[model samples]
Target: MNNDIPKAVALRYDRELEDAPRVIAQGKGDIAKRIIELAIENGIPIHENPGLVDILMDLEYYSEIPEELYQIVAKVLILVYEIDKKYTSNFNNFLEQKGGANT
Candidate 1:
C-alpha cells in the first residue's frame, strides 16, 4: 500500500498538536471517556484495553493504518482543524466588533 498519505496525515496531526496543544487538549475533553460509554451503550467491543487516546495518538505517530481507516482519520483531523480555525476566527471577530479586547 502507498504510505505517503498516512505519513502526511500523521505529520499534520503532529504539527497541529505541537502548534496548539492546549486547544487540542481542551477539545478532547471527555472524548476518551465518552467513547467508552458509547461503545458500551451500543454493545461494541470493550476489551480491557489501554486508553484509547493513547492508542490513537500512537497510531497517528507510528502506525501504518489501512487506507480506509486512514481516510477516516484524515477527514476527522481536517474537520477538527477547520472547526478550530472557525471558532478562533469568530471569537476574534466578536472581540473586535465589541471592542472587548485587542490582538
Candidate 2:
C-alpha cells in the first residue's frame, strides 16, 4: 500500500471553518452529511466506519473526538461543523433582533 496520502486528503486537512458555507452548500445533503459523503466518495477511509450522522452528532455536542494517526481530517470536519452551527445561531439571532425592531 502507498504510505503517501493523496493530494485530495491533504487539501481537506488545509480547509478552515471560514470556508464552511460555500463548501457545505455545494454538497448533496445537509452540511455534515454532504461532507462525510464527499470524503467517502473521495476514498478517504474513516476508520471504525461509524455512520456519518453519529460522527456529526458527536462533533456538535462533545467537542471531543476520537484519536487517529491522521487526525487532520477529523479536525477539519469539526471546524466546518462548528462554523455551520455558529452561522445558524447568528442568523437566528439577527432575525430575532429584526423582529424586535419592528415591534
Candidate 3:
C-alpha cells in the first residue's frame, strides 16, 4: 500500500490459446519482492516500466491487459523476445565451444 514500495506484475499470453496477455499475478511491497525473485530464479525477463506497472496494478488478477495498452505491451514483449533470442544464441555458442550440444 505504500507508494514507496516496489510493485510488480506478471503477465501470461498464449497467442493460440488466448487473445491477449493476462495479469497472472500482481503485488506490492513484500509480495512484489517474491514475484521478482521467482521470475529471476526461472530465467524470466524483467522489464522495468514503472508507469506501465502502475496502470496494470489496477487490473484484476487473471484479467487480460486492456486493449488501450496493446501497443505498449507489444513493445515490451518485443524486448523480451530479443533478450531471450540473444541469450539463447550465446548459450548455444557456449555449448558449441565446449563441444557439448549438437547446436
Candidate 4:
C-alpha cells in the first residue's frame, strides 16, 4: 500500500457521560493528514491500527459505536489514557526541574 496518502479515524468517549464511544472524525488522503496533524498539535495520542480503522470507518460519525466493537475500542482507549498519563507525568517533571530554585 502507498503510504503517501494516509487514512485515519478518530473516536471520543467518556464512560461517566456516554454509553459508548463515538466517531468524532474519519477521513482519508489529505483529510487524514489534517486530522493527524491536528491531533499531534493538540498532544492527542495517535495509534495506527489499520484493521481497527477499517472496521471503524464503516460506522457513522457522531454515532455511538456498536456493542460488538466495545472490547476493541476499550483497549484503544486504555492505550490513549496511558499515553496521557505518561505525558502529564513527563510535563510535571519538566516543570519541577525548571522551577528547581523557586519550587
Listed in order, each prediction's TM-score against the native is 0.38, 0.34, 0.91, 0.89
Task: Evaluate residue 6 in candidate 3 and report its C-alpha lDDT on the 0 to 100 scale.
Answer: 90
lDDT of each: 0.43, 0.43, 0.94, 0.90
> Against the hidden true structure, what lDDT does model 1 obtain?
0.43
What is the clash count for each candidate, in the order shown? 0, 0, 0, 0
**Clashing pairs in model 2?**
none
lDDT of 3 by residue, 6-94 (tens): 99999998999999999999999999999999999999989999999999999999999999999999999999989989998999898
Name the TM-score of candidate 3. Answer: 0.91
Q: For candidate 4, which ten residues in a row score worst on lDDT? A: 1-10
Q: Against the hidden true structure, what lDDT does model 2 obtain?
A: 0.43
Error of 1 at 66 (Å): 5.0
Report how far off residue 69 is in candidate 2 (Å). 7.4
- Tens digit of lDDT per residue, candidate 2, span 30-103? 55455557767865543322233233333323232334323544555567667767777998999999999999
Best-matching candidate per TM-score: 3
Give me the runs in candidate 1 sitting further than 4 Å from their true place. Answer: 1-12, 15-31, 34-68, 100-103
Model number with the top lDDT: 3
